[model samples]
Target chain A: MQTVKLPPLFTPPTPDSPVPSVPFATPLPDIHVTLFRNIRNAVDVRNLVIKGDPRVPECVLINAATIVDVFQIQMACTKALLHQQQGIMRTRSLYSEILFNLSPTNNISDAIRQFGISDTTTAVAVVMVGMQAPPEEVRLRLLTLIEGEPIPLSHLPEFTDLPLINRIYKTGNVAADRGQTLALVVGAMALKGHLS
Target chain B: METHEAILIKQGAEARVYKMPFGEGRCAIVKERFKKAYRHPVLDEKLTARRVIQEARCLQRLRRAGVDTPTVYMVDTPNSLIYMEYVDGSSVRDYINSRAPMNDDDERLLAQSIGKSLAVMHDLDIVHGDLTTSNMIVREGSQSLVLIDFGLSMVSSMVEDKAVDLYVLERAMISTHPDTEGMFQCILDTYGKSSKGGKAVRKKLEEVRRRGRKRTAFG
Candidate 1:
């Protein structure tokens, strides 16, 4: 991932920081091929993450300014994938929407501190992870990086025409008075014929 | 940031790992939360979310307190995956397994840092439920050991819980790390000074050890 420090004016409206603001959340393009590839890798990561290497992914630390841009990037990915779908399946693989700004005062630390997800991860595509670390780590101590052809979203029904699950936490973001709050979001790619 | 080709590391019980590409082509580990059929659906959801939250909390705390661990990236709670900066080096297990013991000062320094970290954790009332040597990884560069997998941890003030956590690790080290008897003591020696239950916990540790001795003798 490339980090382009957007001159102050390009920054999105941040929760706390004094950085300048802009509306980073943008609409998806008719066919954003680059985004489609990423979403597919993220959601259908079974082959990439499970049977994959054992090194850690380089982390990109986000300040308030860049976080919103990242959100837009993810939305573009999901939308791009969704637009390329063929037909509906027995069960949907993708789920989106919900989780509006619960309270205007909610910030990143408060979100991380409370197990409430940052607004950044609104539309993430994931493949697989298990109860413990992946099984691949045992055999190969140091893994070779992921190297292969990129899978197109068209091939993966799970990503192409995904479905949105019921709304989770639409009533608000952070609970009133920061009292006890319980938020839940459920999305799963059903194994073929697993759920009717 | 130096980027190395992605490598597959050992997978643990709860997460799948990948050598993720990071800044300047460097690699880090990406953990994925896969599904488990053994657990009831409700229980699974609770456990998964709690564990993710707990791990993230520990990393944040460690980073802030100046203890070294990976920096977190993309906390995809839905996917139950956390992407973070990968530490480049062998686990303490690997280091001990291959090279054997180090000199007095090296061992003391290693033992002291570990002791200090645990002490810090306990002082903060964070109990790492599964405190095996495997959970403590030694990273290169700083030669600092990082604590990974706070999956079963809880924030508690109970002295018994913290003692048990250390006790569990002592057991794991004996079985796993080679020639770890006296060497491991270096860690406790340090832990005894800083831990809340320093004296009492050490005494209980002896009882736990005696029980082990008796079991081994009987068997």
Candidate 2:
């Protein structure tokens, strides 16, 4: 389990709350990521996402093999937050926006198809954003939803589909160093919609 | 307006740069173009939005062309904010000022690198409108030159545009650093050798220098 606390950039406009609110003191919510391998309920999780199940938190379920590093996820999460802040999300939900932000293209369906979960997926990375549940509670809840062993994020490299990622990102050669590949991939994702 | 803690590092005429914490204990530089009260709201919004998109486009294009640039993290269009990688290094301006009487080899090396990068940039039709020592950073360990501040950058394949770009850098170098004519010459020599259309741009640069940046209809 890995947790990334995204610091707030700006205070949200104060709503008409019954309690008096401080002018500029809202702490932005954090994003939590948990890796699961040997999953048996990928189809079920996908179904939940399709149905927009209330049981699921505001989260994005990604095929862990497609991820190059944690930084990639962090970048995607940051983009998603920006999209949400601007009220310009292309997808129906923030989770879908995160998944969309991870892809190197502007097509929403294509992004989901590439990064979203599949029926045969054995490894998954669950990214939850701004959840009120504690980390332990979230992990336990995820165990109920997904029949898999929770693995540390450091083990992600072992399951990474490098060839697939390279093809998707068009990162030139296979021998490219991890740092270079990561930079190229992140650059592609960031430049998706704005490419001219 | 949800507010997070961000330290304002630089307040320029166009944007306010903030060093904010990103995820995974990393930091990102956020450039927010504040709203201008003087201009009409609609025009200001359109202009700011266009510049933000243009800046991001140029940075990504250069990065794809294998130029060392700060990786863009996110662009907030509504807020006019561009989040980018926080380059951990000093500006070329500071580096040059700190080094008292740099050796010939060091000057040559730096000139060659700058010339090569500029060549690549111009070859890609990117005119870094405000190229200067202050806009380039020397990375800490690698000592690689990373270009920054694409606020005025644009894509134009015209020889005149490319020439003007180089002229801007030359004038900036002359004014900012003392006794840099030899260094600028080295830079131009390397650029002429490396870039595909460098010869044409160099010829045009001579004309640009003679005319002093702006072209006159009478001339």
In candidate 1, what are the lDDT values of residues B57-115, reduced to their tens digit? 66655544555566554344444655566777777777777667667777778788888
Docking quality class, candidate 2:
acceptable
Q: What local lDDT does model 2 show for residue B13?
A: 81
- CA lDDT, every model vs. true structure: 0.46, 0.82
Interface RMSD to the true structure, each candidate: 15.9, 5.4
Q: On residues A1-196, what C-alpha lDDT tens digit does candidate 2 reach at each position?
A: 6876664554322223332222232345677888999998888988997887877765789998899888888778767877777788888888898899998888989889889999989998999887777777777778888899998888887778988998887766632677767777787787786674
Query: Mind giving the per-residue lDDT tens digits that candidate 1 earns over A157-182?
Result: 33311111112122123222211111
Task: For model 1, state the Cα shift of residue A67 in Å.
Answer: 11
Candidate of highest DockQ: 2
For the predicted complex of model 1, DockQ is 0.03
Evaluate candidate 1 and give its CAPRI docking class based on DockQ: incorrect
True contacts kept of each: 0.00, 0.45
In angstroms, give how far residue B27 of model 1 lies from its true place. Answer: 2.3
